[model samples]
Target chain A: MSQAATTIYVPRDTTTISLGADQVADMIQTSAANEQQRLNVVRNGSRGLYWLEPMLEIDTDRGRVAYGPVMPDDVDDFLATECWREQAGHPLYLGLTEDLPFLKNQQRLTFSKVGLIDPLSVDEYCHLGGFEGLRCALKLSPQETVSQVTDSGLRGRGGAAFPTGKKWQTVLDTRAEQKYIVCNADEGDAGTYADRMMMESDPFALIEGMTIAALAVGASIGYIYLREEYRLSEEVLNAAIRLASEHHFLGDNILDSDKSFSIEVRLGAGAYICGEETALLESLEGKRGMVRAKPPLPAIQGLWQQPTVINNVITLATIPTILAKGPDFYRNFGIGGSRGTMPFQLSGNIKQAGLVELAFGPPLATLLNEFGGGTANGREMKAVQVGGPLGAYLPSTLWHTQLDYEAFATVQAGIGHGGIIVFDDSVDMSEQARFAMEFCAIESCGKCTPCRIGSVRGVEVIDQLGQRDVEFEPDDPERLAQKVLLEDLCETMTLGSLCGLGGMTAFPVLSALKHFSEDFD
Target chain B: MITEMNSTEEHNNGWQASVKRILTELKDKPGALLPVLHAIQTEIGYVPGESVTLIAESLSLSRAEVHGVISFYTFFRSTRGGSHTLQICRSESCQAMGSRELESHAKQSLQIGFDQTTSAGDITLEAVYCLGNCACSPAMRIDHQVYGRVTAEKFDQLVSALRTNVIEVK
Candidate 1:
């Protein structure tokens, strides 16, 4: 065995960083240097098995071996130059990294190079089949590029599941003085970090994806409207953009072709309403993030009154691979109309909370049971909220529902951003229902009266329902009538509101009431 | 470690020149107001109420318009906070992992509500919806550093560490 033949990987993902990967990396480097060792310490992005971070991975002859949930104290023996090692004796060791069932079971398509490579290394990115999609896109006509994506059955991974090709084709066909491609990176959902992961881990992929979109839709300039909460992402993305520009992946005349495109990373202040594409555009234009009435979609007129394509970060990031491999190759992975894999986020009260990218059609039970390892406190799992706070709080009865958008819709649930937050048996469903209303009231943009007024009324009615024995004023409705009133308020918010902030806020509240009626009574 | 708020007032003395530097650097960029405001905040703690007029003039927006934009978002603060801004995540995932109890513990230990700084002027607590550290739930961010899997005891230790560190820095 060669003495200098080892590379150590420690994740630089936000979660891992918070968990002390930096300290672990520093300690390992110091220990290695003390032993006169020649080792490469690469800060890679996360593989999404967050529970095992600061997970330490080493390059062995067999493959990458994993050891982790490692503390700085446990890193000393790693650099003990005994000509390599035994992991079975180590308490933190978890055998070969890929062999772990959690990672082994996942169908990681977009996240292929996340924890394996330096996110900003354009050279490493190219070696791992990175910009092959953009190269492939460069050869095809813009119209043909759009056609191939349509054939791939790729829809927006950003909850709405809009047909990506249709959105692209609109911009392609539009007659415009200027055009824009805006990537919605404002990932505000509580349990969802897939966008952040993809951006942090393999940013080149997103750049490549956006470049392909630029080629497809004839957009010269792109803007990544990232949220301010993601400080790490801002740093990573800006560095990646500079590197991409230096390498000729971005800027005027890409790869010496007639095509020219550029990208800018713009940060959004804290407003959940800005996740809506129109509101995002308004924010990009330095206006308040209020939802606009839809008749002219963002594709028709967006970003300084020009043709635009506004896609979610994940949706755009998935573009490179689809073009690299073929429509059929990507299309073969998923079931029915929900083509391709989704990075399903499992968080909250689960034992093993992390990102699990799977082909569509897996039952929710699979994610909750096979991937999540059940409840964290060894308690019975009572409910799970699929999607964001706006999504439904599903009971165990609906566990059989597939992860597909259509399947979720059948059960009055939306797989919105593919985030499933688990709740244990001790949860008060009435409180959960009330929280949905309260959240709506807090985040409402006040563009419409129904959302602004109805949400506050929704909270009042739910509170009244919870305290059924209270003496009612002459004007106050009875507990049973209050329940009916809450339902009516939710309906108004769902139908009358302009965007998902007001429109879909009813999903969780109504679902909680429908599934856990006993909690209300 | 408890310091008076006078230091913040003293820091504000140079803010006019600081705001000018920020305005001169970023005012011409596309959609410049947000970036300019963010820069001023980074350089001078929060967006000082007076700087709004300077920003408005530079960006060619009315004072009311600039203030409207600032007030629209929870992140853009008009007043200067304590030495550090401590934002605890209150979203669903964190709540499910016992952030509510952690939040109450934080309030009790610090003797302050959300959005209110203590008399010491060393720590300011705020409630944020999410920090995207859901996997290791019950998360909080102090300045730009996000910490996860935080319990009541952990919160206490973190504050104590911050207190000691801030004293050493000053």
Candidate 2:
């Protein structure tokens, strides 16, 4: 470790620095150069403080001193005063980073390295203790490695919250000539950029995680099926793969262990349905994005009819931690069966909308109030959408529910993608319900009738309710009945659709209707 | 940069040149229903009809396809563009929080839309599908910038201040 006493942490979040972080970073570098100070500068991911970034942190006797909302012009004065060491007042100084209750109270696991390292630099990754999982996995027997993940209780972060280890173990147990590892980087969920941020900020972690998956599954080739919108992340991740290949972290004879694994990236054309495992596999094979029937699930016949282990970006990214920290360490953080931290994306109308990695079952109220700082506009909280478009809308009455996967589900909601979107009193639950149906209508892959045609009809019904047609008055018993019918229609879509694209929409729409019926009017 | 130009140059081969020449030949006629723009795009690569005249002469009709084709599909762009045409879906499904307004904002900011161009010519803006990211809705793409749940203000600032040169010229 370079014992460089002076290191600076600057946040590179766009929302935080309306003026931009690049200019501030350059200013810091230039000032550091003039002073002949050996400054270890890292363009860490956002600390989720959209209000304060380009936030500069300096090491001090008290703790890591913090300054933020820093602009390029202020860099000179920031250094000239050396006030950070003295705790002298500077307009940019937002106080010690660890003291911020928003960051202090929360647990960080999946996002441990975000906004803390150069996302592209392997050296920075190594310094921050990345690839430790890969190192551990290389030592463990394949079965032992699989067992470790199983013991960790880490579920998929990709909405379903499925057990990741079991999914990988199924592939390992299968006897097939060709097996594969596919990273579901197709993060189509609204109010969620955890996958994108991770890919852009720590591509190696994901790559390292995927490499381990390939080893455990007896697979040789790994594919990262990234959405086309994430072009920059694709470039960064590809570059990291090339670097990892050169360093023997990937490619033939990885880690000199006789295990050969090579990873490649495939871009998904604009298709929300492609986020589904089977649909994603189909798109990878050059077909129009459409869902495929499961049961001959992806684990058995996926990605060109090969037994493939498909995991979301965050799920695979957590592999290194599970291996490095031991299953018990990884499993001990969260409540009940939902162990380990979730990379929860705080977005939409929230005040401090950004990625937050916290233990499961944190009260949605606490998440919104303590960490998120409530809705951005400071209006009365009306409804909060947990998960994505298909996620349920938790009205203010249900705000006390714990945010664990099962707990949220108990209330007819799921923490799909761990994205919490806040809506103030101004939000109309009726309009939201209608929008959910409209969204499903546009996104359904036309593979299954229940999802395709049903979603379109669902939208029409919601529109009818919105327009206040003579058929159903707002407060009429028939209106409630119509809502129930729509909910039932959603249920059929949930059970019948090929994937979450159609399934998840029901979660939010139904919850909105059930919890906040008045808003629908 | 090399990859972009090589692909464009490769796409601009004899077939495309021949198509461009023919389109240039039929520059004028009443309504010139050659549908030359789409026909030329199909014949060559994309709608290379930079001007109304080029589209007019290409097919034996007037520049109707040039106008009609440009307006018909969301794909056509009159101005020269970067290698990738990143069309972000900005319809109602994506517009619950203002994607409808975002489309116009993106067009004005990008200095192009429906069939326009940015001064940089690196990206061409067009409306796309739910982009299959409706869960995240209000999504945008620029050869790969899949920003979701974006606001009009954020979109405007991102476009106005984007430093596309982040990628090194390989």
Candidate 3:
């Protein structure tokens, strides 16, 4: 009798690899070879259920059977067992990969095929409705393509929340012999891995999106400004680009058409300020990552004084689906002005921390409780910082706010980068506030006085406040003076700073002060 | 101790040669300073101060310009690092998961603070913002290998193992 072939799935995602997934994969491969089992191992992306990472899935005649947090020592027993045939008696077996509540609940439009496909395979990407967008894009005029995006109501996912279609239209209107499409993959924001996940898992999607952008804006060359820490992303993206180019999806005369586009990956050298669009442009030009003054926005005079279309990785990755499906189909998923699905990353002290892609306008409480599964330690949740370091720290009282951009704005918060970092009751909001100032100081480009000098002063003022023991009374002179001074400093930094680096530093500091008043004591 | 000192000097000489070779190879590339700096640090473990002059002269830039670029980034170091680097994420996400306690444990165990090398030259501790493994809080990287859900005990075990050279980290 002929033996049937067995397929084993392992994640090559960074988070999974960090938990010794590679070692587990090696063991599985070696053990299968030694046992002479007809096994094929494929390294796929993370399923976003991190608690069960090193999560190996085996394709059986019944379905895909899952095993989790698998160690190297368990490989022998795993291979010996008939657990793949049935999930009845195995301790590690998790039946059916998709049935997991954490994954099945998510509305994964952008991240639909992340964990399902082999990341680097162009054929796999094509099979999963990848190039249909580019094919659709090739037939449309540049104005029509821009209008499609405008009709979709996609905003910048990189925290600015600017309309993406308008930015593209501006670049399209500009007359330049050589324009560029820059994908901002410099995801330095804490508690955010969506950009990295998109780059590492569905890299070709980002390339396809950028190619679509290139076709839309009439730009021939592009660059992905990637963070330095994402070494794996760099490798995967470059390989995907090469594969796409080889398949005639990129480079000269793409897909036997007049359109041509090429992309190069540029690594940022450990500067958080480089995540800023202007600073990123400066870093790309081999200069200090100082924030450039605006008016001549990057869309107008960027990358050697030529027009450029710069969009975040998620923003670009969302383009393919929008182009393939109609604009209304994409727009129907979201609420209010923030149309479309967002890959909200839950981290910090969360119990079931991972990427949760959902349509906007879900109550903040639902994400914190339902998606995150509350604090990992079962401690009382103190605060949740929506967005990155510069985002506001909201107390539990404000948890009812919706995840829409305008809704967050009403509460003096911005959903910057869609990263929610939960903090338990054990957290000291004062220390967090101080860290905010310190981070700004360390990452400040020193272009503006309010950010460079004011951040240092903000730290000193917060330290002085920590020393004081006065209650939160309006008439308490010493306390009142310090509060006023801190507010003034925040105001200066917010208004006087050259870029968002200085402008948004006040968010965390001021929000912590406002919400966690007891922490100040 | 004397042999160790002599070996350190010999290592410095080798680093100089490697830096020169790297500069020669990457000098002509467009916007090569950052890449050149990255290559030097990758090869020598840290960017030495004297090498800044070498880089500036090769790239036809002022030493101040080179120094500004190097110092602007936290990853580049002016002095030599220890044999292994242990970078603990100090960002709010990791902080929420008792990284502060783990950081204290790491410092006490190594008898060194962040950005400091231990007296034994075994490990250099540094603070990174985020490792993109936020799902696994208290994430740390020992050299290029990232370890997640790192507890005080797990950190200590890794440190001792690294000090003893019992197992290669990767």
Candidate 4:
């Protein structure tokens, strides 16, 4: 086989694709050919530095030198320069890939392979030490495998922060003819895209992670309940499953042993409620995506009334590392109760919006200023919405809170899915608070009255509050009554909702009122 | 009851035959309602009025159950739309990127509201909560192709090209 002189790496990530990466890739191949050069092009996944997407990299003696945000139109002009290593006044040059402070500072445990490898090559995945986790797990007893995860202190990354090992143990102990392992890929959070990135980046890691879960819990069947909006992830996962099956990593009698596991990709309709596990189970049954009450948690009676294990994409994806390197290796990264690294997705008005996989101890200020570099519009920063739409809107005063679960909880905030959405001073807190209630009303499953009905009422109350002239009439009885009623409404929803939809919608509204009360006036 | 019967009668034999084919292919799978619904929507632009009763009967569900499932999710629409579906993200991430103005520009340019088709029947504008493209905010998806950081100028150009059939919507 004749080797190509040089290789060009262009990301096929969703964000890059939307920025016209495919067009750039096509142009690079043609332009290099015209220069009498035999250049190989490989479509890899994004490094999560989205602003520089279509971030083209080339192999050099120093390492993978990067340059980017390259349009198809710029490909010929840059190739014509013939001074790639020397920098030669090219406008898109970003220096070496590893030297970028945004990536160099990251503690990336789960996202290690994301932008570096061709996503679908099973040989490359294995060759780079991929399936060692499953191979290690096969030798241990099911209880032992579960114990390893428990000792690692890994909690569910899917917002609730429940211990993943405890949930798996509940399913493992329960006797049943069949058990199910479901990976919740219904990441509907407005400002988060880590789950989508991981699935599109390294599909095999998820497959391997789920296989380990099935082995630990004695589940024969697995399903990845992916959201419908992620059309690209669907394609990547289907192809990955096919490839893994061919290698005997899946299906009956895997790897010359008496083990069997298979995963099916099930699509969720546009219901945000399905992100809630019980509602997800209901939707998987081909019914309306409604929430189920919790007398019997999903661990004991789930799916078709059988034992089940449901975990978020990050929680499952982290499993392979824990099993491969032992619990201590994974446990040493985090602080307090929250173990391992969290893939914090930074977006919105932030100048350097991207994913930062760091251990759970950095203050919110570090992530916002150091990695994010404040708002993109060069304005003063105002509020930061942590978690998702349901999360609280924090003011500058709260920026010192560390990224730990317990630490964020102290400030009425959360590390839910590790999403940090920055906003400029132009943001109207009252409007954001109103939108929180409106979003809940739109997405609530109607399983409980407070979430279903209270959200609508919350919207109306906020509208009336907005109309009141607080400057002229500080003693207006009607305005005072409405403010009390708004607080009461938030209280009722937090106490009475069946799921997080109602329970947490008040977080943003209440926080906005407490911190940015002037906006309400 | 009479209207229901009339609507079913209006459905051609070809529609019924394809619906039957979809049911036969997916009926045996566990929790097969969603896959069946997706297949039907894929075959036709939207879930027709008459197919609910047929789906209910085939899947051993009540007619109310079928209707409830369709109405519960925003993705499933009851009526057919234009050649292309333009879903603008209305969630916070996009909102922070000035999608509020883009929302206005899109509605004015097409003379349509969310879930409504344009007057010329070339586009259907819809509101989506999020498309998982938050890093590149102010995102909109036309069919499967998502466009990011869309300014009002960019929006106008895409709309004109779409009207002229420059890109395949499907």
Which model scores highest in TM-score? 4
Question: Model 4, which residues run further than 4 Å from truth?
Answer: A1-3, A33-36, A83-89, A468-471, B1-13, B166-170
Local lDDT at A494 for model 1? 87
Q: What tier of docking accuracy does candidate 2 attain?
A: incorrect
Report model 3's interface C-alpha RMSD after superposition on the true interface residues: 1.1
> How should the candidates be ordered by DockQ, best one leading?
4, 1, 3, 2
How does each model score on TM-score? 0.96, 0.79, 0.94, 0.97
Model 3 scores a TM of 0.94
Residue-level lDDT of model 4, residues A1-521, one tens digit each, is 37547777899978899988999888777776776666778899899998888798888888898887787777777677652443736789888899999999999888888999899988888887899999999999999999999999999998999999999999999999999999999999989999999999999899999999999999999999999999999999999999999999998887777999999999998999999999999999998999999959889999989999999999999999999999999999989998989999999999999999999999999999999998899999999999999999999999999999999999988889989999999999999999999999999888799999999999999999898544537667887898899999999999999889999998999999999988887
| DockQ of all predictions against the true structure, Cα-based | 0.73, 0.08, 0.65, 0.82
Clashing residue pairs found in predicted model 4? none
Of candidate 3 chain A, the 10-residue stretch with the lowest lDDT total is A467-476
Q: What would the per-residue lDDT of candidate 3 be over residues A207-264, giving only the tens digit for each residue? A: 9999999999999989999988888899999999999999999999999998899999
Q: By descending TM-score, how would the candidates be arranged?
A: 4, 1, 3, 2
TM-score of 2: 0.79
The prediction achieving the highest lDDT against the true structure is 4
- Candidate 2 stretches greater than 4 Å from native: A1-7, A12-19, A30-41, A60-63, A71-87, A468-481, B1-170
What pairs collide in candidate 1? none
When candidate 1 is compared with the true two-chain complex, its DockQ is: 0.73
